[model samples]
Target: MTGPVSTDRASDEALAELLMRWVPQQRWFAHKSSSAHLQRLERTPLDEGGVAQLVALTVRTGLGDEATSTVYAVPLTVRHAPDEALAGALVGHLPDVDGAEAWVYDGPHDPTFTRALLSLVAAEEGAGSPAFGVHGTSADGGLPVPAGASTKVLGGEQSNTSIVVSAPQGSAEAPLIAKVFRVLSAGDNPDVVVQTALAAAGCERVPRPAGWVDGTWTDPSGATAHGHVAHLTEFLAGSQDAWRVATAAVAAGRPFSEEAGELGAATAEVHAVLARALPTEPATPERLAALADGLRARVAWACTAVPQLHEVAEAATARVDAVRHVTGAPDLQRVHGDYHLGQVLRSAERGWVLLDFEGEPLRPLAERSVPDLALRDVAGMLRSFDYAASSGAASSGAGGEGAGAWAAACCEAFLAAYAAGTGVDPREPGSAAAALLAALELDKALYEVVYEVRNRPDWAHIPLGAVRRLTSPPG
Candidate 1:
């Protein structure tokens, strides 16, 4: 006995109802609290002639307000029989689709989909329906990921799903890792674009990108918008993130100043290369004014979100003014927008390697394309050092007293090395560069305050402390 063929309209309506039930439970879903009324934007078939049909879909997760609505990229394989191998990746059951016994499985976990995903990318094919297109690009001489390769989905990812693909035919073959964007937006996805450029420029600090998928989708307003769908890169073997190494050093009371300095130098080199490789614009007076206002806005937001920030709000805004007064700031360049200990991986072969070129994940996609001061990355690292110290101290029971001094030492060492390479020092307490860095650091801390308040109230103390220390530094 087989179910009747589900008409295209009926299938979409059923799928929309299913998504309303399924998406909220997904880790990649953004709107956890708000009620979602999913509107299918577009659906493109990745592969249609197989036992399982793989389709890529873009859906709007909310209704009415354009600002409130979020777009999501959803890919799934519709098959006749339940794939016990992909049971864990199962999204739900679809009773009818092209007369097959539709059992829907998450795309990344579907072997048929993952295999074709890379092949499409390697072939650099642009395909889709009348309303939208999905394009793929593979680097010159890119190798193929064999069909039915063993793939595993990484756990604990919040915004996207990552799949680790291995060559099942041989153990010696290097593995591949692919990131599929869950939330979709038009324009540049720096994670794909920037890193791919850096890799093509022979930058060793970033993993070499093998291939990527970009897509164009019709919005509710019927405008075709483009953005990256996924990225595939080499999986670094025997690599550990710098956060773990940094924290271990602090926990054991071992000096991390040397490593910090090296990381800073590495960061500076990446910035230099990025500045050379990408577009840059002078920091015009108007841009500076807008920057100051943006900083002040963050401070205001933090003040409202975290009541403790209210007391120092005036002083925080004052730092923004100090930054505004500073003349001849560095030219805006394309650097790692979100640079921190966690975003770096330490490898015995490669040393300090930077990955994830996507700026701040929470920031709007359009804003990320505009180049900005590289000092923002500097401030982000400075904040990361503080978190590392705080965690190490808490774990060791050595208290924030020692942690503060250690963090200060590391910060100073980092700045000193970075300044040596960049020819612009941000270390001196009263210097112009220092003023700008302070303002930027405070803004980042305010961001952390909001994040910690919403996610980890206990950890809010770390950022709150930075906010206070920045506003009123101890003599």
Candidate 2:
């Protein structure tokens, strides 16, 4: 009922004032448009030395009756031992109270926070467990942070926090990057299990794991918390994320034939590795039926949130109907989960190196972990290509002619490359695979529409166009 509480030494009055201003500044803060009512759920102390003591704050915000609470791992610094770099990254400034300035940690930066993050990653590698702390019985489980390993926050990453860890003195390589998992879920983290398995299977698309960290803690409500990825892997440097390169190619009006082809080949190889490493199961009618049901539910949800998704919803349903008749061995292999242009990297010599094995953001952890059609990942990449083209068009103010042409060219090149590399026929008829892919792409775009409308109303058009295109009759 009262304003949100802060578990820090700062008085409730100071914390409330800080929360009111701070909630609107965060990228992840859900209720930015309305006034926030804050309530503190929990806090953890980072240091016991009495100097540079940091606090992680979990706060709940409400707009009248509608409310949602999210845990934010914020680190605070006392005025006497202020961290300049940390202070500069503050999301919102607390009014100077009693000669102390309270600053919130910028989820994107903060070295002290990075150090704590590294502890989790080092814990994973040293302990021979998954980088994320998911405690499954699988071989890729339980990564623990090493003693005395430190971390430096990396500068890039638009959606997640990546921390680079310096191996303790007298180690083999320079520093390794440990990407801390932000969103928490109850199921096994795909990034840890799948990528680790791929690396073990000699898949060249992902960075090798040095270590991982994972564990469970009690929530404020006293429920047993499930394991989540704290951090994983020390990938090679000097590589560009595939999304940026693809967007650049589109914006410059350059044909992405070579890049798309390479991407396709790399994707095929990734699937092969996944198929080999993960346990397989026959694709029963029940599993396929369930997938269709899930897609239908997702489309229904999207239609409610974004009115523009109606066309996509109908088309997707039709496609699901067409695929319902085809019954083949449903191969359940570990997949990349959330594959896209951004989740990949282009290395100078090794070609496409995929990053972030985390799957679809909306799916539950168990669903993401369960092996499904490899074509699902392929569909995800195809959708990403559309997103890149649209994003570039929107940014450059390119008209329909330019954007449409570029999107078509990229799609063709990428498919050709992928087909050649994976030995899958892209043009084969009666396969029903292409229809399945289109349905998935439509589903992904619809999800994006909901997300963008809620978080960024301006960018909603990108997904809206995709929905319309998928629903329209072939000309």
Candidate 3:
């Protein structure tokens, strides 16, 4: 066992300098390209009992005349001895309260932070815990942590850190996966809202809700900001994401219509549950016009970001115009805004389990929380199918025609199943549903073009091809 390092916290000035250099490199930090200055506004400690301390820092970034602040919870672990496992995660050594220099590390990689997190969730208190002002609750009323539970942090997550807690032998509860949100927002996260609602309504299409961590803090301006910091859910062991499954099937030339159909059915089930659990509103002409405007704005922004979108700018506008002029529109309700194959899992026993309802990470929390056209989700899934086809073709060096055929088959089967489950045929031509679906599909493709250009330039052609297909006149 290693000796405990002294508990002297670094001064705010020294910490700010380190964070200024570190924040831009983090995957979850927004505004990376802008030249900005960071200032520490507040720091709250969630845990300081172990070899590490989990501290939530509200940092403000000022760029020119504009300024924005966000809360980030960083775990700073102090160690006197060199830890090989944490060598890569070292933040820097700081002077301890005991006048000894201690090695500090990023908390997520350390077992101390992970273990304390699980212990806190297992305690499951709504108020008055170590995380003062933060509320923690069990989604299923109570989540018992099995004795001798083992902990391991999962890898490759961009926005959040996830730790898996495996139950010991003969435990009643299943394994739990806890997601610690890196960038904090001042509102209830839709992931918690939607999953808890569905779980309460006995919706089996989602993983069982285990618990969540939330809190409120006053900003420097005296405005109170509420944040959902972390969430814990039942872990689905041995489940594979749909992207890997679909792309592999395409690469092997196997038909995926059956699985696609079942996935569509599962999506419809969640939609039905969300409609019942949350507020719903009919889609009026004014609302459709607003939605069209939103798409138009995105297209404009995308054109500015991705120069290739300039060719399709007029075509996208026309499609949005068609949606605005449509006579009747479907009802609007809360939806999975960023629905894609990767957001779903194919479970052997559960069929299909949906994950992540936080919507697009870039959108404001308010907009993401509002009810919207469910067809948006459908459009996103359709785009994913196209992406799978393109990716598989590239990987296997298959002809475009073969990949297109596979995508068409999946789209047809998935839409048919969704229609059957929801009593609305989005594939029906010349109908309001069809018009809305097409417009949303184009919007999603346009969004993808920008995202690909910015993040994965090589993959930009996939969505660019979609833009060309949607815009070109059908023979």
As a TM-score, model 3 comes out at 0.91
lDDT of 2 by residue, 1-475 (tens): 0112223445445745665576456554444565555444223333232112222234555655776544433333333334566666655555553355655555435545545445434432221112212221222432333345555666655434676666577855545676655544554578877778887887778877655545444443545455554545755668888888988877777777778877888888888878877887766778777777888888889888877666566676776565556554336677787888878888896888988887765456677887777777877887788778877777777776777777777677777766776666544555555666666777778788898999888878877887787777755
- TM-score of each prediction: 0.93, 0.77, 0.91
lDDT of 3: 0.78
Worst 10 residues of 1 by lDDT: 50-59
lDDT tens digits, residues 226-280, model 1?
A: 8888888888868998999989988999889999999989988888888889999
Which candidate comes out best when scored by lDDT?
Answer: 1
Which of the two candidates, 2 or 3, achieves a greater TM-score against the reference? 3
lDDT of 1 at 146: 44
Give the better candidate number (1 or 3) by TM-score. Answer: 1
Runs of candidate 3 exceeding 4 Å displacement: 1-10, 47-50, 60-62, 65-67, 80-85, 97-100, 126-133, 141-143, 169-172, 219-222
> What lDDT is reached at residue 424 by model 3?
75
- Candidate 1 vs candidate 3: which has greater lDDT? 1
Judge candidate 2 against the unseen true structure and give its global Cα lDDT, from 0 to 1: 0.62
